[model samples]
Target: MVQQVQEVAQTGDNSGQDLVLSHVTKRFSDFVAVDDLSLTIPAGSFFALLGPSGCGKTTTLRMVAGLEQPSSGTISIGGRDVTSLPSHQREVNTVFQSYALFPHMSILDNVSFGLKRRRVRNPDAMAKEALEMVELGHLAARKPVQLSGGQQQRVALARALVNRPAVLLLDEPLGALDMKLRRQMQVELKAIQTDVGLTFIHVTHDQEEAMTMADTVAVMNKGRVEQMGDPRELYELPRTAFVANFLGKSNLMRGPITEDLGDAVAVDVSGVRVVLPKSRSAAHAGSAVVGVRPEKMRILDIDDAAYSPTANQLVGRVVDASFTGIITEYIVDVPGVGMVGTFSQNLGQRPAAPGERVRLLWEPEFSFGLPGDEEPAEGTDAV
Candidate 1:
């Protein structure tokens, strides 16, 4: 199946291409896999589509790759409409989770297969350069079965890259590797993409993988995009509770609006007041959900010590303490609300033991507000 890609002619256009999807959607029977999704991936930019399984991320990638046709809308590559084009005619290459290398062929032969079929001159020389790009030039004589998992994965990458397609689509390409090798490959993949200056559209369910490799990330939910931005922007100011919880660990507290100060609003969470800036939220005065990341919160020893009137503080009894190498995670039980988790670095103060009373301190600016009762689109919980 992989060798069939070699039969397609290599496009002469050498420039990188921007991918644009306008109101693209896919429907399977009565189920809509993707819904009115529009995105713009700039030329030479590394972008990631991230979500849990069955969130339409893979379906969206398939639409762009011409593997799956959209029920409605159009897809354009480099300002040329290619929605109706076949996969072989789209000038795009895909590297999937499976290496799919030819076990009977040598590494160099595997890399040159596509070029040879396209009638490119000096296929062996071009293939050697591609192998060198992946730091596997020395292993050209080895067969697929002779190489380790990482080396085989690199050979697969070399195969895809030898054609120099306008866009490179990666669908969880590191999912098959172990944790250590996967981390190593993530760095190498991003570095290679930078060196080649190609537009890379990667789809992955791992948040860390997307955050580490891509310059921009789009978090998908159900059939639509929930949030899209740089890793820092999305992590710091999640627009919705789902983004807050799914992207990373967050403590969500629901409360009624007590004070509206235009730029900021104070919410009363079970007799405790917390202020969040309005710019980080779309919710007005009423009920809202305030989110604070576990790392942003600090655990301070409190023994009948009154906190400052203006400070954001939550008094809780420590119920559990867990040491996770560089940091210690503490689960505290607040009075009205349930358990709230916080992480403290192991560099400084020792972790408080269970049953110890502590105060959670965090800046008001760290909190993000969102509508408490906002109903997400249909099937939003698929993640």
Candidate 2:
């Protein structure tokens, strides 16, 4: 499949076609859907625009696809201004969530429709190769109704790939699939992007989907980017409370900065002094919100010998514990802190039950600090 796609890729040079959006903003009278957004997507990379609904990710994608014009600023592809160009004129194709395959047309004809419209020679052959690239050539004779949801999605993808656009836009293309199939498609879509070497800008609200398939992820919130970077980096060191809470579960400890230790800053959390690495902190002098992921914390008995004296520790009573196969999730409530969550790997030992007093400990370096003024509930509701 990969070799076949590479052969088709030789038909055109799709490399080095960077998609650049400069200070783009889109407004509908009173509502600003996308605000002063500027992004440079490198060629041949899989990038994801991730956010909750109405965060302007879809608006940004529409502007890139020429479906919606930006109220202001320029949209360019490969140094050429394409801001005013219609969707058809731009070197881009979009695979929508609806699949949009012609119900009556055979899969091969459906895939070949765009090529035929553009007067490309041997459209059927090209489309067949595309089907094979997606490993759907054997189903060419079937109609859309005859194929399953996952197969129909592949047909839609092949239809878009047959056009051989420099940039491909995926707008929640896997939203219709079940959980297991969605995960399967994520891997396949990433592999297809690598095989074709086309710049793919995926817009999705699913955090796992964005993190799994994209080489770079831009987390947008309320028409602006909260953070953008490699998925691992963004997860490890979130710059804002929204990113910390939205990307995954984070326990935020808000307090004043008591001292700066050159390499780390000390914050008093409910009378417990916790240290955060200076490089990981977005706040320096004023009060800060310290954050750590649930998986980074361990629930230990107060007298556990494994407890390190230097580690950040918070004592709390277990409110609830839910065992989910590989890991047990616990909700612990402390006197000063409202509620803190922890995930302990199930290693054939009994989990700490409810009402039991436990200590949550994590390495100080694992902590990240954000501005104290940022709302702790900013991105919690969206999840």
Q: Per-prediction TM-score, please?
A: 0.92, 0.98
Candidate 2 clashes: the total is 0
Q: Candidate 1: where are CA atoms >4 Å away?
A: 1-16, 304-310, 374-383
Instruction: State the lDDT of candidate 1 residue by residue for 203-296, as single tens digits.
Output: 9999999999999999998889999999999999888777787788888888888898889899998889898889876676889888888998
| The best candidate in terms of TM-score | 2
| Worst ten in a row by lDDT for model 2 | 6-15
Clashing pairs in 1: none
Position 360, candidate 1: lDDT: 93
Reference-based lDDT, residue 6, model 2: 74
| Residue range with the least summed lDDT across 10 consecutive positions in model 1 | 1-10
lDDT of 2 by residue, 1-383 (tens): 77789766546887778999999999999999999999999999999999999999999999999999999999999999999999999999999999999999999999999888989899999899999998999999999999999999999999998888889999999999999999999999999999889899999999999999999999999899989999999999998888888898999989999999999999999998899899999898889999999999988987787777764889999999999999999999987878999999999877899999999988988899999898776799744
